[model samples]
Target: MPDKITIGGVSVDTRHWIGGQRVASAETFSDSSPIDGGTLGEIARGGPAEADAAVAAARDAFPAWAATPRAERARILHAIADGVEKRIEDLAIVETTDNGALLRSHRRGVMPRVAHNFRFFADWLLSLEHEDFDTRGHRNHVSWDPAGPCVLITPWNAPLMLATWKVAPALAAGNTVVLKPAEWSPLTASLLADIAAAAGLPAGVLNVVQGYGAEIGDALTSHPDVRRISFTGSVPTAKHIAASAAANLTPLSLELGGKSPLLVFADADLDLAVDLAVEQYDNAGQVCLAATRILVEDTIAEEFTRRFVDKATTLRQGDPRDEATDIGPNIHARQLEKIDGFVQRALEAGARAVTGGHRGDGQYYAPTLLTDVAQDSEIVQEEVFGPVLTLQTFTTEDEAVALANGTRFGLAATLATGDPERAERVTARLVAGTVWVNCFFVRDLQAPFGGSRLSGVGREGGTWSFDFYCDLKNTVTAPNGFTDHG
Candidate 1:
């Protein structure tokens, strides 16, 4: 077993969340590994006090940090990316131990993506250019300003990667940040703070606090000093945060849950569809953009289900650290229980388990595929953040689009088809933020990533993230006579 880790720069004798250089407490909570029911460490049950401290620290640093030159800020981000690359192994181990994600997935899939995000945004900052608009006979110019101190709350499923999605842009836009990492997986956030310090970030520029949502999270979201809040989690939690932000009229960016769909046309490459489906369930379907509701055209539904079931059944589930393991345990026991309940409810509602519906003693659920799930069932409507996919069939293009858009989620969609005209038509009609014509989960950091509707507002990644974290200011100039006449 690994040794217990400490937050901030000092080691505390008692369990408490650390902000800046202080040890504070609200309650005590033990963190356990999902791989086995073994205690990993304990965090100070941080409540309102810790959250306030973190916000204060961010407010204090905002003036200097925001005033810093863009080039200098870009340098710090680049250096942190370098530090992360150097210690990839250590970070991957801690990430897997905390969340039961496969070590290879973290090392290969997540780490590189984060590194690319930093580099891509760093270049964006350096090359940022103001737009000049001609307003009739007057001259107008636009400038982007930071949104002041920001409160960032991230989920456990893809902690580091998702955190980077916000952090890189917020920093690039010159905002001080107070980060609240999910209690289930705090180790990676702590390690990231250490890396930032090594990269020469100013004191209090980035603050991390770990605790329950009701306690610490409420304080951060409601704090007056926090000018903006960016959160990624469930839809219900997002609604609560939205309300809290509304009370203060603070700006927010919420990346809520999704029940994303994948459309398989009759002309789609069958072999490719099966491979993508297997990979979609690779991380146990914890991803917000997991293509869970597979809508296949009736003409090919039989063949696709047969192949999809065959591949999904062969996925290896075991210890996350094992290199060959394809699927690891869920993030926690509670998550496993929630997933089980959803499956059982769907079964009772007349859904049939096509393959792999068994649960192990540990926090592990086999990759499950269900058929004949009612369109309005909980399994189809709710975001099941686990390794489960419910298959449905559609006879026509209009039916496929209707079924895909049935849920409130509009995050992502996958369309596999060999027909070029059909791909173009379906891709244009899909009500999703991202549409993959021939692939699934394949993304580039330079592309804008986000959802259309309840999947969340605003965008992340590419040059768009800079716009999200910054406030656009339009400057207009006119001759004295012209202004007086108007």
Candidate 2:
């Protein structure tokens, strides 16, 4: 389009990356920076044509790429990781300017993990060995064959990190990928496409088509040629994608919404508990695993609420580019309004805002903590997806578990307790995919990750990732070396 736009001092190209080339769209949309609601640049507005083209390219590339040696694929993945490490600063700045996440966190934590996503998957792939066993005089060999063309859809929050989380595993499993990033922050995905190309990825192995879901989602997810789909977003959209994918019965993995809880036991460390509770405000509470609903034991509920409010109020909200700022603005004006509405409605329903309950200048909203909330109210049961926390009191271990599992969402939960036995006892019973004991937001990439019930449909991490990206085939041979023992 127009020469090249400088975003946060880094040059950016805003075109769809398909078949290892930059392709322009018939129409374009102006992208904005949430920092000050300023126009960043014109991004290609892709439609069905682009989506079809990307899938076709992926389909065309799958055979040769899948046939390539695993070691060579691993080498290419390492190269991609190297490219990501080299451009961390530029990637972090462009992501922050576009999505309104804290720049410092991006530079320090998010970007590094983005690189590790590729490295870890590559190393994990190289170490894996499919087992072959004998069954009644026959040998059964287990193999994970690469599935064909696939589609990956990621959300706006933590765009690159999450996209690469899916992309790394899919690519490592030898599947061709057509990544459709969220419309809100699509720039970095374009950058990543270029990185993969520079890292010696074959044409059409990795493609990016950026557009609004309404315009391009159906085309990508509903394509009959798409063998697998991985999506991370809201429940409604997940349902939409599922419906479309069901036509071809295409296998899909969904990582969806949550109204998770952080339970604090009376015997827990007060400092650790308060710190974990306040961390729900990080990323402006845009995280799907955020423990927005807090259940504190009756004995320490008052004190915990007081400390949580004080810490939450201390969070510095401002421009995302500022190193000193703890939280940045909401990604869009509508998101700001939606966040405030949740607080306002809670206030109207007799919930008390102990710290913050209003909006700041531009797209920034105050980190809010609500108390005296009704357990059955929408504020406690629904995912606000904002810088808001709701507190309730629980008298015993059973009550705490009940409150933690109260919502339909079983995405994640945090339990704070001094007793190891209780941590084991209660964490086992909590209805969630992930449980954090005496901690919050500590992630180990090798562990299984996803939600139960409404939060999501499947898990993805380590072997779980490969399981989803590849198909299992068992080869049985009669009279093999070890099969003589019946």
Candidate 1 off by > 4 Å: 1-22, 479-486
| Model 1 worst lDDT run, 10 consecutive residues | 8-17
TM-score of each: 0.94, 0.98
How accurate locally is residue 385 in candidate 1, as Cα lDDT from 0 to 100?
90
Which digits, one per residue and each the tens of the lDDT, describe model 2 over residues 391-433? 8999978888888888889999998889999999998999998
lDDT for predicted candidate 2 compared with the true structure? 0.91
Give a tens-digit lDDT track for model 1, residues 40-88. 6766667898877778878888889889999999999999899889877
lDDT of 2 at 175: 98
The backbone clash count of each candidate, in order, is 2, 0
